[model samples]
Target chain A: MNAMTDRIAGVLVLPQPYVLFLGDTTVPGFAKTAFGLRDWAADKCVGELRLPGATVTTGLEALTAAEAHARGARALVIGVANLGGVIPANWRASLVEALEAGLDLIAGMHMRLADIPELAEAAHRLGRQLIDVRVPPPQIPVGTGRKRSGKRLLTVGTDCALGKKYTALALARAFERRGIDSDFRASGQTGIMIAGGGIAMDAVVSDFEAGAAELLSPDAAPGHWDIIEGQGALTHPAYAAVSLGLLHGSQPDVFVVCHEPGRTEMLGTAGYKLTSVEEIVELTLLLGRRTNPAIRCGGFAFNTSALGEAAATELMARESARLGLPVADPVRGGPAFDVLVDSCLA
Target chain B: MNAMTDRIAGVLVLPQPYVLFLGDTTVPGFAKTAFGLRDWAADKCVGELRLPGATVTTGLEALTAAEAHARGARALVIGVANLGGVIPANWRASLVEALEAGLDLIAGMHMRLADIPELAEAAHRLGRQLIDVRVPPPQIPVGTGRKRSGKRLLTVGTDCALGKKYTALALARAFERRGIDSDFRASGQTGIMIAGGGIAMDAVVSDFEAGAAELLSPDAAPGHWDIIEGQGALTHPAYAAVSLGLLHGSQPDVFVVCHEPGRTEMLGTAGYKLTSVEEIVELTLLLGRRTNPAIRCGGFAFNTSALGEAAATELMARESARLGLPVADPVRGGPAFDVLVDSCLA
Candidate 1:
């Protein structure tokens, strides 16, 4: 067990009843945090606060920061997952308004909210916390890679922010439905907020990346399952270190490769094509063998949100036949997902 | 080019002409920092300071911190590289005494020297700097992994604290001797002290690991070579993420596999066996191709300090023949090392 787990876990105690803040974002993809909170923790979300030009919504009731605070919202959660996790200059007014209205500011951006002058001054004067979940806890030990007793599964991807988190969440829910013991081990900001506890693997120092992952899912019961949420793709140019470290430290006995069809280029990278599912599976097994020799590919999960039901079903079946493994969109849970769960457990 | 390079290069201005402090370390391996500085930056070093039980020496003139300060040394460099980079409790008195004697303290340990209460108080009172080289610079951009123009040679090891840094230093010097435009890019503390300026790759945030490496060796003339000092090994359970990130980011055209023959277990890892040079070669090529498809293994370097001259020679020749590559000890610079350097440039 990680010695710092208890102390580190205590550091991220966010106030409940949040008003999801959507900045000047138009794309629905950028509002994943709001959508995720609404989907997984709807009861905790009082409403959503959107800027003047914002076009995307999490379908919750809209409210201003003052209105949300009046309605008992204790914090304003920045719900946009932008390209660089940067808070725009235009968002300062809304953030300051929240602090003035007796609410804390919560963010998962790369840049801390406390670093922004207006926000920092407002929060300090208001005596409200400026919580940045992406800040890793200190003194995370280096990974030992010693095998621990557990039945583990991980959701890996061909790129960033595709469907790895959703797949793991769905798998863990299915395991619970079957009366199987399991936990959804989150590794990112959204998933951490949803799970209410997880280490921000990317925020840790490079020397302790794997150690942070190992601490995320410690030893469990022999039959218990840790459906670990993955980070970057192993083929990703910028973030593969986090991916590889999580893989080796999690030591998953089985893995599900997540992909998004029709996506050509990697996120935030040019001239780099999306890696093939076959390549992902091969590489996962090859590299994962360093820590877990019995690692196996459970199946594939395709984010077919752009495709109709018939087209998505046809593509999944065709790929399943080619790979000789179960394949399904975990979001569209059905008999196929059931088969995937069985194969993963088998 | 990196915009922050110039600013970061100015952060580590160590007042040189220093005293190297060995803090109760007996094993020569644990005193790598002292030896590395003595071997690479002898002109900057004035004398050595040892605690009562310290049995190791860098073969420099022994002088107390006060004596060294009187003789024009400006700082006391913590020259021990123990297993965790920790400062022993018994050595705190010596460190405080150095500050009393008007010497700044420079350390590459995981913990900052300024974080120690006594040292911090003394340094504050004395107005002396406590420079911690392991602290990474802020806002390192994510690696793009676009192939930059310039040849690179990285030295990869089978375990930690072996010959990776030494081999890179030797290769860079050899390149300069051959009238080649080259630079030795430091990635660790001792190397940073020797080279005067370089990134501490292991200290950066996990998300920016590759980015740090990319910034460490930026674009240069087509004929210029960047001999990068490698970090942890790819097969290492605790630190493979750092190794893999450096490999992908540097995009080394040629890499030299370094090993310490006759070692049974990995450093600091009890059950983990040492990785073979063959395994490292295969893994480096397979993973390194993600960034540089033309990546090649140039040769092998063995730390033959534990063996007799005849035994070392016989083993080098046999291994060279078996692997179909040049093999030599860079420290024992001879005709074999010359051949190794020739093959690396080929």
Candidate 2:
């Protein structure tokens, strides 16, 4: 995909410029993963097919399968990797209808759509492809654990779906302006599509997770470093392992811990409380030093989406004091990148 | 291997028992992994061949290749997965000589000896076997993200090799006396050999790390719980990822924090200071809750090897007070397991 309109770009909106989200992504928890996938490309979403009793964002209309087809939608993407992320029968019926309507299916849940024979058969008969973003690359390397000269900065997080990718992307963009020389090493599908040069780390077999990290951190150009996108939190229950491999394999010189300012509970866990910024910074160090003692906590980047500008600023100020490191909202114009590059790459 | 005369059983007293450690494992940093492996089997070691001036534990003699052979050495194990854990040429020569000596070779480093054609050829010509403890199981599943019952109590640590396995083992043994019903789920070679079942978490492909955790946490048998040996620290420079996967995959109901008393600096990281007990515990919760929100820090277990008994005791008391959790060394009798069970399982 071209850099201008990456995969998330298309996923956010379909080729026919009309899309239907199979599941209502309006729930606070279930919508975290898939809802964020296309928020940047919201215009393509014509409406969502709600599974009654679910509320979603107001951007899309609630449409039935017939209504979605009558409206000219091209694909049916599972918009929520819900509480267990399994494609259940209720959802299956909707997916089956979508497939029979000849709509392509795109999903990023732990469960693959093709795993269900009925869905695979329906998609096959319908002449539409089922895309599983978590699929690993055809080839992956065994990690050499060799150290390199170029600096690597990875964005870790307090929990899953907490803007790690956004922080890394912001760093990449900031680096571009500063001419500090860097590459955004994508660790997920949204990233891979955006950067056009990364592997979906989760799809890779566990043994090669670190290897994928290693491969992603290319030998530096004469004046370049790699700003690798961090995956799940090292503490994330569902995806910590994936994040761990990225941390070790990347061997980053410094890491930035991403946090959601108003997120008191971890996304997937039933209701685990969030820890303070100071503690997270230290905990991250405990994990980072395993591979590289020189690794440092560059700073913190808050996902300030839930807060007003002033409130986010106040929270960040408190966090900065707590961790004694640079902190900012990487999403908006801020100092996180400056602090990240200066302190880390300095 | 027989439980009574396991591999470690022989390494502790090997000249009469016969042993040959291929590389120098005397340095404080490089020795942690290998030294721990056979320190329990020291009497079996004839001598560890050195790279001229490379010192080893006082227990093992620094013997020449022929001297070790004359001493009836039967196996050639790479004593150290030294700096970067790579197989360097300096150590390769000794491996070749050991093969010619008709000794079996065992390695636990990131580098597999079998990957080296010349080394494999030498072993083949010598009729000696090559054993890689870290080799992952043949097949690992992508996690179902399903929640499980039967208390999964995983041991996490401030750093690697700080006694996570020891803690798990201690819990297992303690549970045995109390008839509490539990399995010592091994995650590393030492734990594997000790428990007689487990996959080397690191050896498996990255995607399967969590899968390994799932498999290790077998369908709970009736009322029995699973006390899984944890691997690598969440903040380890090189190994946080491995630890992350183990934490997420195990889906423990409660976790015990492992620490190395008086270890101001992390093992491999140059000059990187360790974090506080409170931070590690909190960080672990952040990761654990992603899978199980109720995942609590059961207690703290200290590796106390670097400090005097009294100093270690003082350290534990202070840490316990600071974190409001019971703390003790798992090796010697203490309240860690009790605190662990009461706080977590209750």
Candidate 3:
């Protein structure tokens, strides 16, 4: 039987009232239900974890590590909904013991993992064995039987809350109205497909990288290409193990990115800082070049409401000329962005 | 010297780093030189206070009550910056004694106040007044030599982070481009104006009426009219107080409100019983109505990106019909939004 030793300092005994468990079959079945329901439950669960004056711990304590392995339970899923404010040091120890006892971690919400160094250390000790579970980006689920024949377009953005989803949805609606086939999928969500199981792999890998980076060099900037790439490589094994668990049923053709003008300047939030409109256009070109060199990039769309349309249009034109790609201003009263995208794909 | 009685609890301290003393000099030179660096340094000389952590206290011992007072402090120039978390309770008694012993309550970032029920009772026994400082809604700053002539437009969102600031900035830029002058201000910054010496009396009266309704009957469906009137009134006291400070410098013409969609649904971070979108919209419209009636209502601007142009247009139209005021959809592609507002305002 697993024993609680004094070495485990942050032994947070979750109030019995809040602890919940779903059997293996039952859990997967619930996830298979409506996507909105799944997302809603996931968001609710995360919210519960964020409540103040509550301590939560998840793992198989009664069974030995060997027994857990026999039952196909390689890791414990520690769900952290929020990581704001001060986290006690004792809690850190419990987290370490849980991971050492073969528990993996999954955090929901925008968490500052760097704030907790102990968790990172525990993750490093576990190496490639740990897994992070996050929501799958809003993409067309597999087996829906939707087929794409015309230019299958996909749009991405520089960061969350930068009007990426709205722009993508708008583009999709615009394309559908025009009878052009298109798909919407975020890069993190796509990474899940690449990681195997139906589970979204990008968020997990992102976490692993963040954890490892914090342990190794806490000061290193997060969401940076180098850190992200390293985390992806390190978590590849866990991802492969769960490959069957994560499956991407659909794919898109042309990928378009909603470019935020001042992304580069904002370090931890989006990844880079944005100095000028030219920088946003250039960043899009660079992303296309680095991610998929052969895929012809369909122009850039700016959040004109945030950045003036005139300024955005001027910058796009300058960047398009320099990069040899078509640019479109999706802002109302300006040229139709959808028309430009369709023409480019054609 | 004042002696510490055992009745003190936690203290809520408001530390002001700088204070600009405005004497009887209207001359720019005298205003600038009167409050030499020494006057500002006086804040640091104020000794720290110790208070209890449990229960509510009154007078100097009651931190929350004291803070409520400082929030409405007039005839004094104090600025708070870089405050650490609230002070612990242990220091409350000592701090209170110090304050009573001729230690002027100069502002600093780490002011401590106590919150013990016993201390509150003691203050009551002594007949020390406990007044709830009224806070106001957002308004533009005065003395920048800018005036609102044609219209004083303000954009607010149904929820925070709903792209209100971006949209407002966009509209401002658009108006500037079209040779139509406008002023831009954030609500939070405007709320701070009260400390800078503005008093909006009309807004305060409205908030009082609304606060009374809320206190009288607390129910789920308190009706839109009541809630909106309350919010307008509640926010008005603070808004008016700040505006009073600003009016001492300049004036503006019409006031515009960039309508935010929902309130309770988005404002409350924690999970609560779900409320329908219709209910939220109703409440928002009510708030708009009450606020518009009280102020020189200019026009309305909707956040069309989240709530599509169609829904936003419909909502604006309904508001116009109900209040007989003009509304604008600054968002490009919004149907009949701009035209309606322009025509109505003209």
Candidate 4:
């Protein structure tokens, strides 16, 4: 295709199943994912839609048929499954058909596979291109032993408007007042900083590529604690997807998901509840386990005025314990919320 | 016009301006009376160009012309002037022309006798329509023999995002803790709240209309103690215009204009520096004298983190005495700043 035609056709990697496992539920994560893709496509001026897939035994066949329908698809993103295995036999024909139709498959594998000869052979037979998303095992540096330095905690929140960023910053400030060298990672803030570079194709493409590379590489140097900030209402799924990409890339020691108050009760106009602190935390923990198990995980930190620090702490503690992780309070106490930050990192 | 066509052509009056004011030396006060007329035939989008003479002068000619131009305008907004009187001749003509062009002029001042006569005459002449922006002024009851009881203090910040809302909220909290009854009125926050309602209009239009109605009406009650936050980074002229309107409308007992830390320093993106805080203060004091001679005004509240409590207090006292108003500290104690809400209010 010519340059203009290629631009119009727009090569997109549609993740298989159209939705990945978010915690234990098979909810409509597409709207959220699609929103993120839309945000990425903003400057490109491209349109995108997620293919539908069933949850039952016919799910694989259904996904393949959907892929077949996307005949002119230039790229295919094979979403990583929790369990590692070969492609199902029933769906093999559809996969070959997709390749014959000139689809470049990008297989994202969360598992630490020693080899993928079978998959490679299948792709070769179909005359398709493949890019393996196989992340290596995380390891601490030689000198940096796994010695607990009194739980050097790193807290992260969403954005200032959403109250998560402030909550995290307040927690960090509280820790500082208490003589704790806690690192507060405002990933949302960093994302805003990066995005503020302006909505341009090259910028976004570089950001995505860099984000992907960062996700695959595990760096032992102390992670820079940053908050994530944005203008739009927190319901946009793009926020959640970006959060996922950042969390995966940064490999934060402990993730502290911050959320707005009363967000859990509201029917998010974005057709999903990525703003729900509990839901996001659950998904983060699940993704962490599947993508990088070495990264230790924490729990949610909700706004104090919304959830009340005590209730929020207890509820989060219960939830974290259920997930076999450390418990932390989202908000600090007066002077500021002091107990919450101290306990979370401790 | 058909329903869809009418909907497309319908003028939407946004009730607030989400403005980021940048710069220091440009204007001494807020801009309340600026008019914006977009040429849909050219770019089909509202360009950021303020109408000349509309803000500075006033008369029927300027008003008429503005109205005539607005007749074919997809949207028309009349920013209420705070200081200036009598619309300029050229501006009158422009306004009338807009009305004749079949534009829906949305304004808050349509109820005023001076404004109403022209509006009705223009509507009759143009055979067009008009929509008055109706936002009821805040009501605080007063009885016979009722006099101002408690001290009325107003907090004016340097600009937006300079921690104005934070300072205001902290001050309120501090006063509450000190058993002092304090009420807050922030034009900045109010503007944002009104805009968040999804009123389809531009920032300048909404803000100007809301500001004019809020500021000028005698029926409007100023909060017991108001914290009028200014827009930060005064790059846009609209911020100054809005600030001026707020200042003129909500005549306060004592005005505390917050100044940045340094007289000559670059902070924030716009690189704004208050070259002559004293000169600006003098100008404001002069304007205050013109409006209300008895009104007392406070000098600049320079944000300092290095000064000791005694030094800061002394500085405040000296500045307040110089400006003929009480000295109030936004951050109490020297450099180790603690938001001393109670002590400051007290």
Candidate 5:
């Protein structure tokens, strides 16, 4: 049995929830899964999870997610893209433990945890909720290959870990603050969990990847903005297919090109330089215009975390003037969005 | 019941076989399937085919592929990518008729005709044969991400109808004539039936699309060329995924870019001008080198069918000189093969 030793790092400003993880993340084989859970669930996580040989960090105790609520834990997350997405039999007992504790189960894997008969029965009996992150929403309409009403924007990044999701969220919030109707549409596991109703694009089959996106970004009311969380970069080799699918599927009316201020190399390629902002915008329009010739790149959403406040602000201003579009660090502050809205949105 | 009427249009130089077409291909709905049969089976077909409303064309009779064989027909072809790849139940009777005549059935759809129990049992009882064109061979190994021996080539086109398959076949035949040990790897329906042993690349699921290519072009014997037939153009919107998958999966050592002489836009896109032969080469190499940096575009393979013989030859020569590589219309005879071999085939 794996137990946790708690060490609280700082005084919690917001009430942090505990989450019981369901993988033996201490082992090298499952470490990546454990790390991913830690990174993605950093916000709510307060206690350790129930898994064999799990290493508990952040001074959180390990308990089943069901029982974690008693210790301030809110959701049980099974974080892993396992082979065939199956949960081994040995893990079933712990799931039952979580269920008995009435923990909400959040499964980010392709395998639907709710499909397990025993777990489903136990959850039902205990009145526990089970969220399958990868299951696509039903009633996704087929793409009409025609322009629709309102404006949609996708946060496309130069590389993974460049904060496309953060920008999308920031933009959605900004639109709301500005008295505009807006929605944040997630396309990945983290985004799905955050939005509470979106498909994990990576887990979807290729044929339906686009279909799922289409479902997520259904036609919005006039003057509303749909800020879609984009998936992989177009330059990524293993992921380019999914990226293109999402682009074609969403048919965004406006585009938000996200990028890191200092990074220069592509993530997966062998020392391949990152495409310039100008080139990426042109490439995106070239492909997007195949479906909607009127589709245009609205502006840049730069992640200026690596730069000082003054430097980031100055750089954003310079680029804004040069590109003649809205350029901003949406999470912090910038001016890239106004021109973008004026150019693409009526 | 469908019947055939024979018409002898001209003196037949080649021994052609009669086939009983299953569906009423002459009708509006099934006409596409019927048309495919006419296209792919042109060389081996005799007078006509058997179908409910099939009309005798060019004085040829209509009969079942099976019954036609009995009357000197060679094979039965299911010539359509039917909805859900299903052969209509009423058509089964015609399949039965073909089985009675001992005709070998060729299925080109995602659905395997042999998988239907009734058809399977009937074929078995009558000792007839069923050929599934889309099934990947068993025991295909996973890609190791390691470089393998043997120089390989793939014919990538500007668009679908630009004769990539035609160029691949021409180059392979040309290599054989040069006493080179090489093989033609098929990746589409027409190429599959022609080779008699290849998977329909487009019908495959996205995950295994690359795996199929890897399986087909396993480490070859020293000094032999693996000329792979490519599917779809990278510039095509709907078809780009399959095309990219083939590119990534095959990991070819050499690129043979194919294009038509006068084609201006992508087949299915809205006013999308074809990227130049030069840019395509650069893009192909950029993507190809993601997996294998040593990968290079050997030269261009132009389909100059629209031009006169003299014009075609002159254009080929000019491009060859301009691109400084072997440029050719292998089907119509050119020097492209020689330069391609010299540049790529060590």
Candidate 6:
């Protein structure tokens, strides 16, 4: 295999049939990976493994590491998405136990699982892999902005952690349901775990962010579509670089602005206000045009988990009317969502 | 010192009063580091060391490793900014000789100097340092976009390797001449070597790029000016992420668009075209406004080396008239350059 293919293969190689380890996480947001795998890649997950004092559950059958391994699970995937993506000192013993249970320890944390001495020693002795999905593949080429054949739809956002990945996932599913050739392209840790393969764009070196994005979605059949999960918003103070790089490299023919209504301030940044959908559409087009001049906004995807059904419906309607674009909560899966899907194909 | 301060200190620690090593490069463009040191940091650079087959001259006294060491040169700074920032296999023997002559080896290459086995062994045996300025300091916090108390001027470019760093350096010098409280902030490898203590923004992880830029030019006295060197252009396919991150983090109050007069295609990329000065100016203002709402374009700095003295002058005047902004070739300092400097202050 060529070097790029080899590196991609190496990065994507993970022991499968996972027992999701949801470490003492009470908040659903913190347990996003466990929940994501349960919802999206349910077939690959054998069961859920919760630590003592854990208050959150993915609703998967609870199983011990040894039990899961006996049931044909090959890996224990760390399913927590903490603030810093760290492996806390309190969780070392539990991780080590999994390694000793004959299951590879898979993590999407910023800190590698092998960096923990106890887990590392146990994994080494037990001949288990410590797969770090968050680590970027080596030697990503600089982006060339060379256009590739195929259709692409990128889910951009006003603030991060809204629903860009979910929108992409839902769109990909919808496209598949319609017998359209489509694939979900992940760009973050949780999404990487869900898709089983993707470059964690944020983890890459700044110089190679676009290149990594390009690698994530390569040339495909002319009728095929790659629905790419986006990173930070164009208005994000810290992460716009990753967002722009993804936008340029993905060269999406259609983009959907994902946003959370009623979010006055941007995530983690107090003084920075969230960008409006109109502003996001304008900026994404202005910047994305450098790579694909034919790029256009397909619609808007609202994360309405915080709103009631009536309120969310009203908001989507208002936004759609004001912006003259289809808007919907993909999870709601109504006629509105159907229109949004049609917009993507259009 | 705190961790941030400690890391910065570690990154900036380099043996000074050096011999600049221009490798077997005949092209002046490839010998930019040698010329930059000879022209800007002349006092710190004691002499030049040229390898066999090198035709480039920095107009400094030529010295061998032993002679340069005897003359109190503490390090041999790699003075070639060659493509890929790599040390050629043929250059290993000459590098090893420098280590043997009791000098620390300093390089601003993509590959670390210590990674070379022969140089590493010699440096270890001689108890000399192998300084790699291309490595970013660890633990850069995510950019908060919290407004700082200093003025900043960033020199943005239409393409890479086209006078952005030189323009920023010249502008910093000009600001100093006017008794303005100012410092030149480096964002790339060569700039880091020249300035001795600035973050290599492009080398930083994509998630921390803006944060690294923020650390490069932190909060200063209200009147202080931090003249930040720009990285890739916003229109650049491969590296716009680095450019946008620096633009947002530096929060420049005034920006100068640096460009070459007649370049059609972008650097390195075959099919990608150059961004117009007007487009650059517009985009710089549009994106730069995220961090600093009052951001404005200062003027333009052109790389007029490809043109004759008269042609360069005529083009500068005509372009200045058309764009209605101060335009000059900073290398060819004249009334136009003085006006350009005035625009920055204004």
What interface RMSD do all candidates show, one decimal each?
A: 1.1, 4.4, 25.7, 22.7, 4.4, 0.9
Which lDDT tens digits does candidate 4 get at residues A152-236?
2333343324544445455555556666544433232122111211111111221132132232222333432332221222122
Over 4 Å off, model 6: A1-13, A24-29, A51-55, A81-85, A88-97, A100-102, A125-127, B1-13, B23-30, B50-57, B64-71, B81-102, B122-127
For each candidate, what TM-score against the reference?
A: 0.87, 0.52, 0.26, 0.25, 0.65, 0.93
Task: For candidate 3, report its TM-score.
Answer: 0.26
Among the numbered candidates, top TM-score falls to 6
Taking the tens digit of each residue's C-alpha lDDT, what string does model 4 give over B316-345?
Answer: 667656755444555553322232332244
What's the DockQ for every one of the candidates? 0.65, 0.21, 0.01, 0.01, 0.13, 0.80
Ranking by lDDT: 6, 1, 2, 5, 4, 3
What are the per-residue Cα lDDT tens digits for candidate 5 across B1-346? 0112111211001112425254644444544444434554455555455556544342346554544676666456665444576787777877777767767676667567878888899889977667666554444333333455776898887877777877777778778888999888878766755454455666554444555566667787878788899877665655665666677767788888898878887765545577688867876776677557788887778888789988988888888888888787766764556766566565
DockQ of 2: 0.21
Residue B202 shift from truth in candidate 1, angstroms: 1.4
Candidate with the larger DockQ of 2 and 4: 2
Query: For candidate 2, lDDT tens digit of each residue in B188-295?
Result: 875553344467787655555766687778667657789988876666555666777787788888888888767787666545467677777877787677677788
Per-residue lDDT value at B145 in model 2: 49
Report how far residue A68 has shifted in candidate 4, in Å. Answer: 58
User: Which of candidates 5 and 6 is the stronger one according to TM-score?
Assistant: 6
Per-residue alpha-carbon lDDT of candidate 1 for residues B88-168, written as tens digits (9 for 90 to 100): 789999999999998888899877898899999998998888878787677688988888989999999999988999999
Tell me how many clashing residue pairs each candidate has: 0, 48, 80, 91, 28, 0
Cα displacement (angstroms), candidate 3, residue A156, comes to 5.2
Give a tens-digit lDDT track for model 1, residues A19-70.
Answer: 9999989999898888998998788889999888999998899998889988
Off by over 4 Å in 4: A1-346, B1-152, B157-163, B174-181, B189-223, B232-238, B263-272, B289-293, B306-328, B333-346
Segments of candidate 5 deviating more than 4 angstroms: A1-86, A90-106, A110-132, A135-145, A203-216, A251-346, B1-85, B93-106, B110-148, B196-200, B203-216, B251-346
- Chain B only, TM-score of each candidate: 0.86, 0.68, 0.32, 0.40, 0.74, 0.90
Stretches of candidate 3 exceeding 4 Å from the true structure: A1-29, A32-75, A78-104, A107-346, B1-186, B189-346
Prediction 5: B-chain TM-score: 0.74
